[model samples]
Target: MSLSPRFYDLLMKGSFFFVGGLAGSMYATHHHHDNLKILKQDLNILHPPTREFGHAEEKVEVSKDLAVRDVLKYGNPGPIADALARKAYVAAYDRRLRHSAWTAEHLTAASIARPPTTDTSGPVDRGKSKFIEDEDLPIPFRARLADYFKSGYDRGHMVPAADAKSSQEAMDETFLLSNIAPQVGDGFNRHYWAYLEDWCRRLTGNFADVYVFTVPLYLPRLGTDWEMACVIGSPPNVSVVLASKPSSPLTPDVLELSAGAFVLPNAAIPDTAPMESFVMPIEAVEHAAGIQLFSKAVKAAAKPICATTKCELIIRKFDDAQKKPNLRRAVSGLV
Candidate 1:
């Protein structure tokens, strides 16, 4: 097909974008047709940089094998990301999500394996997950989640303990730290976790139809780092996935609505919008933590955390490159 140079340029750019994950890496190893297509299309161009696609294929070492690391960052980042998808809280290993593709190279090259996490009833001993004793913010209030820090809230994860023994090797991908987010017990155990489990199976069974790999869509704001840990696979689903059950309130979605705990559903989505996917409802979150959210803004769709279920989302970075502040709303600028 004949096309304008500009249009052809867009096709090349789009192709570069399309081959973004482990699949792309696989292409590097095996797909001569794709390679030749790129070459034939670009042969007439003035000059092809030493690196054609900028940073898509840079090599890096991770703690384990290079092959494993590449799969983690690129090939499987999407599956893990999908498994980790939840409405609230800043999860552990979240920092990795915002890294640029260049970051993948660093990880792959390092081949440094990530330490595993466990469900310690007490604070983690250094190498485990983070629990910085800031002494400033009322971790007490957050840890216990009582009356203090009325406005402050916790972001707990639907999947807890970060235990890889949770599921089968194929399914264990969901246990990656990338798949976790701050969540409340009532919300998660009762509804969110189950929903996530169901979601995970669906992805495994039917997601190949929609597999576009990704890089960190945005830079961490203020240079804050997001963390991640490797979740090795196990037989049968992880014990954690099975243990993830949310107990219903005396009634479903009916918790003691606190001044802050509330749920306000968004208006019927616009017709022009793409498919809409939302996390659990505010009622579910409220029911889990025994509190309400956004009481002041009862009309808004946002919810709040309970005092006892204390969790918090660490805002890592912002995409300040954009001229205007409000427009940069995505976690990753491109995402």
Candidate 2:
């Protein structure tokens, strides 16, 4: 109460300094918490929540490797195991079919570019590479080019060579016989199938990422008990039937094994075709390829998007699609 002037001044200054420091701390703490709240909101958008599957309501863990956007778009149907994860994609190879039951790839704008062009320069010497049997197979069934020689079908690729053009090694990996299917060489492989591959590449220009799922379908049809001989090479009728009918339905059996390809753009599709056109039901792919494509949780979300049969693939030349097998030409041709 009876303090000197200097002491009183010093006391007032110290009080002011103390209050200022407390206010500063409070502001910093409040700002920090606000920033954290915003971050949590963004993460929920990016990572979503774990979803349940089936009537069992089992909660499966989302793979740490996949982003939520990828799961939502691609519907990672697990082959129920037996997936061989390689440099570019994952495949479940079926030796009986001499091709992949199905193959899945997540292509990003970042990954598809050679020099990252909107347009790709198809590989220069890719034709020089030959289809070799996948050494990775446990019991090697030689799906040699010679096997298909004069057999009457083109060695169609489950994962087209154009998609693997990101690198030479990636392109070479695609050549393994395990990845090839006997497709109608003239119409399906060279024409419509190739167009689909081109469509997939063009997707990168519009969206940052695109997911592609492909399977060789042996769709059943009428008047073509003949297709069994040509496609499966069994019943001793394959050569005989191909000789007689150069064009027939791509047959699996009386039971339909339709080829299914689903392309899911992570963002909006930039094409004139409606999204339903590219939507392929997981059930169709599963029935045809005999492999589970996505996890149960992924399937539940993707089913609605895939619930359509009107596809964008336009097959103009049905007659030429089924081609005659050239045995002599097999020695020097690339599928």
Task: Specify the highest-TM-score model's number.
Answer: 2
The global Cα lDDT (0 to 1) of model 2 is 0.43
Q: Given candidate 1, what's the lDDT at residue 225?
A: 43
Model 2 lDDT tens row, 133-184: 7877755544676888886556766676767767677878888887776653
20-51 in candidate 1: lDDT tens per residue? 11111222223323322342232213123342
lDDT of all predictions: 0.23, 0.43
How big is the positional error of residue 103 in model 2, measured in Å on the Cα after superposition?
Answer: 1.3
Tally clashes: model 1. Answer: 55
